[model samples]
Target chain A: MLLQFIIGLVFGLGLIVSGMSNPAKVLNFLDFAAIRSGTWDASLAFVMAGAIAVTFTGFKLVLRRPQPLFGEKFHLPTREDIDTRVIAGPAIFGIGWGLSGFCPGPAITALGFGTAAAVIFVAAMLAGMWLARFIANRPSMSGIVTPADRVGA
Target chain B: MPATSFTPVASAAGGALIGLAAVLLMALKGRIAGVSGIASRLLPPYEDREFAGRLAFVAGLVAAPGLVWLVSGRLPEQTIEAGMPVLVVGGLLVGFGSVWGNGCTSGHGVCGLSRLSVRSLVATVTFMATAALTVFIVRHWG
Candidate 1:
């Protein structure tokens, strides 16, 4: 638990430091109208790059080990086929991101940074989650257990 | 124009960082580093064994920014034009979407996609498309 918290703290702090908590920065990036506007901030890419670099290296190192820090073994997924769901969801997310300039990660981080607006966003996000459950329960959707259903419990 | 904005670089970096975080979490904690999973477990049914790890993950997310601030001396600024109602509504929709989709962009788009999970691919597509449609309607119609 302590380790997890520490990890989360580091993650959050990284967001803040990287300027991800600021919606304006994100908005600028999405603001296509202001082409070349100094306001456009794409710092997220760098942050992501650093993370990816580390991750690629880390995974290689860890793969040699017998097990991980907490669990019995690495739980890497082994499926690689794109489908309708993949196409649709990413498109939707991109649209939302372009429009709102706030993706889920930074939005949550924004909440901790004291953005009242973030509070509303978080609430709505939760509501959306609940709505998924309702939708999943529909007769037509019986066999489909949305990703939301598989997250925690 | 401060003559020192690294927006382009930052965006790429941020994306990579997200990817890295996912990898590390999986390697170090043997976890998927899914935000929804971590946050969801923070409250509710009370599973002690899982609680600590989830809590820690959330903590890292919240605290990473502060740590950066300590060294960089520059904090990102935020601006929201959609107002409170819209943000709330949008967020709720997204939260629901996250649940229904089984994961958010980070979880599915980055992590799941990298691992090549068919489910993740589908979920990511759904999330992206919905968000795009919503944005178009809101921007053009609303």
Candidate 2:
């Protein structure tokens, strides 16, 4: 738990330092068509590149150790196929992210800034998560079910 | 929104720190540094593995800004230009869609992709492309 807490702290601090908790910067980064207006903000692309480069090297080194530093096995995602659930879900998620210039990690960290928008956004987000549980439980939508289903339902 | 306002060097430095955090989580806890997944697992019916870990992680996230304030002597800027209704709808979509998708930017974009997961690659592309399209529509066409 202490380990997780420290990592989250580092992650959150990284977010603020990267200017990610700033919605205005995020919005400006997504303004792809801004080339015409000479206002394109490409800083985030650099951000992702830096992150991916480091993680790619670090994860590879760690995975080769046979087991994690603290666990018996490395718990990793195994699914490889890209189904509708994968595409559709993130597509919806993207729309929401673009509309509000917030994603889960940054949004949660932003709560500490004590902005009313942050509070409302977090509250509504929780409500959405609650609602999704009900939606995911319905057997009507086929293809694949929740993690619970995969665990043997 | 000017190009002059962008801070690539600082952004990259921050990104490296984030990557370090993700890598550390995976190496030490053997868990993905997925914010939405961790947060969701902590919610009601919280019959989750690493309950303490989840709670502690979230607490750390909530505490980060305060730490920054102490060091930097100012709170980080959190500008939300969107109105109440947009935030509401956006929050709903993000919260629900992340769960349904089984991941969000951190989960899919950072960790999953780094793990060489094809599904994460696809999801990341989908969300990023969709985000770009939405921005074009709202900022340009709207």
Candidate 3:
């Protein structure tokens, strides 16, 4: 638990230092106006790229070891099917990202930075998660549990 | 000029860095390096094993920028236009959507798509579509 909190803290702090926690920069990047004005805020892309690179290399190394740092085996996704939930979920996420300029990572990071708005965003985000659960549980929905369900809950 | 503006090289470098990080985390840690899952663990109910890896991953994220600053001479700039209310609401909606979607952009778009998961493709499409609609409604209708 401590490890997770520390990791989250570092992640959030990184967002703040990288200017990712700032919604204006994110919005400008999305709208392309910043690029037009020659004041682009491409840090989000950079941060993401850096993160991806680390993940790629890190996963390769760990996979060879036959076990994760804290687990008996590496947990990877096995399913490859697409469905309605997948389509609807991403579309909603993208729209929110484009509209608010504050995706989950930076938003939480912003919360750590003590932004009132960030706090509100996190709250709403949690609510959204619960809402998703509620909606999924509704009858006739035929909810399909993914790999995420297998993870320790 | 302020230290927050983006340069072409920095942008490209950043993207490359993220790609590299993604690959590295997978190789070294044998994990997907999804921020949502990592951040989610930070909440009250946490898992021990996931907690450590999450912290290290996040640390690397924060430290990379400082490292870049030392190598390069510039830092990215930020500007916020929408009021707090809009940002807050939008963020909340995204959180909800991510939970519903079972992943965020980094999870599905980067990792899942790379693995060619059809579910990720669907999720990515959904996220983008909803975003486009939201922007339209907020910018024009609302």
DockQ of each: 0.42, 0.64, 0.33
TM-score of each: 0.75, 0.93, 0.70
Off-target runs (Cα >4 Å) in candidate 2 are: A139-153, B1-4
Candidate 3: chain B TM-score against the reference chain B: 0.79
Worst 10 residues of 2 chain B by lDDT: B41-50
lDDT, model 1: 0.59
Number of the top candidate by DockQ?
A: 2
In candidate 1, position A145 carries an lDDT of 39
Per-residue accuracy of model 2 over B58-106 as CA lDDT, tens digit each: 8888889999999999997767889999999999999988877878888
lDDT of the candidates, in the order given: 0.59, 0.82, 0.58
TM-score of 2: 0.93
B58-90, model 3: which lDDT tens digit per residue? 555444434445657644344445576776667
Give lDDT: candidate 3, residue A47: 58
The complex in candidate 2 yields a DockQ of 0.64
lDDT rank order: 2, 1, 3
